[model samples]
Target: MTRRTTLNLPQLRAFLAVVDAGGFSAAAAELGMSQSAVSHAVASLERELAAPLLIRAHPVRTTVLGERVLPHARMALSAVRSVEQLAAEATGTMTGTVRLAATPTVCQGLVPGLLRHWREDQPLVTVRVFEGDSSEVSAWLEDGTADAAVLIDPPPATAGSYPHPGVQLATDGYRALLPRDHPLAEEPAIDLRDLEDDPFLISPNGCEARVRTIHRLAGLRFSPTHRVRDLATLISMVQAGIGVTVLSEVSRSLIPADLVLLPLKPDTSRRLVLTGPQNRLWHPALRTLADSAAGHLAHTASCTAGPAVGQPLPSRSG
Candidate 1:
């Protein structure tokens, strides 16, 4: 007696077509084969598996056995397509998710607008945002939880410190946020000395280190009337006449209707940086997000605080 051979590619392909097309005739049309040929393939597949692979009703449907095999078949097809894509992308193609971390301020002010613009340009890439303080963001990068981060205060400038292999991105300086009615509002820019005696609002502990540095540099101390965790809340306090706060120009939009933003005096600035691991593969989505963030930061410098005020302030970046 001759032994029957295992299922062949043609049989599997035809079965898949029938399952997708919902009928043998339709599958035959799609596969450019005769209906009988298509049916023969399905029969062969079923015989090899020793189980019915389809239920023949008015509209044919997959049997339990067919359903079980369908997923594996689909996954196999997907893997083939992915391999082809990778081959095509050998020259260059950006796809997949880019996990990004940022302080609350960067997340609220920079990321939203940037993502809006980036979606139009690179629709294939998805950017997942993680919000935390600078320290937390650093930790996330170190732990492989995020692909990159928008850091406000990077590590100190020393060998193996600033611009570490773990961080590869641009940086920017800080700006000042004040009430529109405040005295400093009239100046095109003001120095830290200009803010003397003003009621100050500071961010939470880890993230506030930069604010502390700013004060220390100017040889002044601000008794913050309010300490908040998020940029929106901190800006709210500034709007309520609670006090003034210094923030990145990227977060200038967070100012309330009652507030205004001014460039810092003597040009004290925080580094707005994009950082990612040295060994991590670069995703097109992440590059788009970072570029969008940079562009939005430029436009946001002139933004006036609008109705977004009094809303629950967004989270802050570390």
Candidate 2:
């Protein structure tokens, strides 16, 4: 007979928390438990499985076996939550928490507006936002840390296409960000070659891939004087006349008043879509949020400052 040992939810939670928070102390703070308790829980789990899960070091990371186990843990937890949500639905009270993930720009630019809309439309549902880089955001959705997420440029139909149902929230193109008094700022549209002489900055937070492609298509070297991770830092550097960068037009709201954003000579656009989980059943609130998003876009279509959702644009790389 095979040995049977029941897995504990708290232990699994402790393990996941440590990995996500980056350390035992941080995980303890996040889970409202002592550091020793968190560590003990993980140790108990490791002993039960007869395998080590994490490397004990600064900013602790998962071992190879832990990586294989994490997705199963996430799915198990999500399934439990779904059962609880079903019970609540039977009571006629439509209320639950949703974890939504997004890149830094989407969190700052689009999430606030969606949350505002949800407040009025689905008052009982609470949304928690997890801000991460694009890759992290995608992984979170797949692993159930995020019930839904905003994906950039998801493929239409292929093996690599998004696996879940999604709705396109907005379609916007890239624009060059420059100081208001800069020489190129006077022009209606700036060509990539014209700015080659100036110091160019690239934000690797999520936009670097598209920026590299833009340079390659323009037949120019993709060298940047600086590679910054924080959008605010990049904006500050550009505002101080240190350099210039390109960003999505959706982020116009976050731009300072002294900066001017102009379209490129040849437009490059990307689609932003809100999608549910890929490997787990959708949380009840996930569908509600998607519906609310669709309604919000339809109502705001007439007066939205950015490009309309799903509108066609010029042929260019996303």
Best model per TM-score: 2
- Lowest lDDT block of 10, candidate 2: 309-318
After superposition, candidate 1 runs with Cα above 4 Å error: 1-88, 153-171, 205-207, 279-318
- How far in Å is the alpha carbon of 306 misplaced in model 2? 9.2
Q: How many pairs of residues collide in each model?
A: 12, 0
lDDT of 1 by residue, 58-89 (tens): 68888888888876664454354456446546
lDDT of 2: 0.82
Q: What would the C-alpha RMSD of candidate 2 be, to one decimal place?
A: 5.0
Model 1 Cα displacement at 134 (Å)?
1.6
lDDT of 2 by residue, 108-217 (tens): 99899889989998899889889999999988887666778988986552333223356788887899999999998989899988899899998877689899888988
